[model samples]
Target: MNIQLNQKSDKPIYEQLKSEIIRLIMCKELREGESLLSMRALAKDLGISVITTKRAYKELEDLGYINSVPGKGTFVAKGNQTMIREQSLRRLELKIKESIELSRQLSIERSEYADIVEFLWEE
Candidate 1:
């Protein structure tokens, strides 16, 4: 719930909110079945519009990351491990691809690129 929005960034506010929530869930900061702030409350806290929080929450629910209960509130979904894992893998793959492209641009050897990866992994 310790979200810091980059108001200067080009990304949409709702997307930033959604991504932070997802990051919290992935890091186990927000555990399964944990209740989240209501849309209006979150909007007020973040100094954003209620519609922005609503859109982010709605998208998260559609993606099975959270669930909303009438009058009860919204809680993290309990069975999204597979989806979360897949999302993590996809992000890793994208980073790897970007590294590979950078290496190619710099004419770095494959072994050297891999060594950098290994070093970073250990750190």
Candidate 2:
């Protein structure tokens, strides 16, 4: 419900909306069965077109993040723990890959990298 749209971002508005919704759902900020604003309402609130919000909602539905009920409204989908874990792991993998590349570029030893990771972990 607290989504921020960046017009200056290289990403499209719909994609930005979709990603923020997914992140909120994964983080449990949007709980299962929680209702979301209608496309028109959200669009008005965000000052975006209804089509853009609709597209983002459609993608979220397609990706199993939310479900739409015709007269009732859209609600968060249940059983997202596995999907959340997968998302978290994928993000961590990307970060680790970046760290490894940086380590190589700096000619850092494996042991030193391990030490740094350990120190960071305990912090």
Candidate 3:
């Protein structure tokens, strides 16, 4: 699944896993109905705990990004674009809010912040 976890990251492993899976789905690398590895298998592959994989899978399922079938396996859910887009926007908004707070603390002007954003957007 091309999932990568950073042990040194401040984010939890399960959150990283969830984000990677979502990124793959958003990038069309994981199509609708595509089966995912079992939680145990993924934990072994990623060198993480089964509990971590379970938590990630549960969150993904709750978010409508994937589905679990008893005795079967997990598969990507269909028609989840809207949900995915909303989630992405929420994350971006949170990040922007943090940046705005930091800029205020540093006395950076709004125009300068906008310029930086524009430069990054064009990069």
Q: Say which candidate scores most in lDDT.
A: 3
lDDT value for model 1: 0.93
Query: Higher-TM-score candidate among 1 and 2?
Result: 1
Local distance difference test, each candidate: 0.93, 0.92, 0.94
Any runs in candidate 1 off by more than 4 Å, and if so which? 91-123
Order by lDDT, highest first: 3, 1, 2
Estimate, for each residue in 33-102, the C-alpha lDDT of model 2 and write its tens digit.
9999999999999999999999999988987888999999999987757975686688789999999999
Error of 3 at 36 (Å): 0.5
Output the TM-score of candidate 3: 0.80
After the best TM-score superposition of candidate 2, give how far the Cα of residue 36 lies from its true spot, in angstroms.
0.5
Output the better candidate (1/3) by lDDT: 3
Candidate 2: misplaced stretches above 4 Å?
87-123
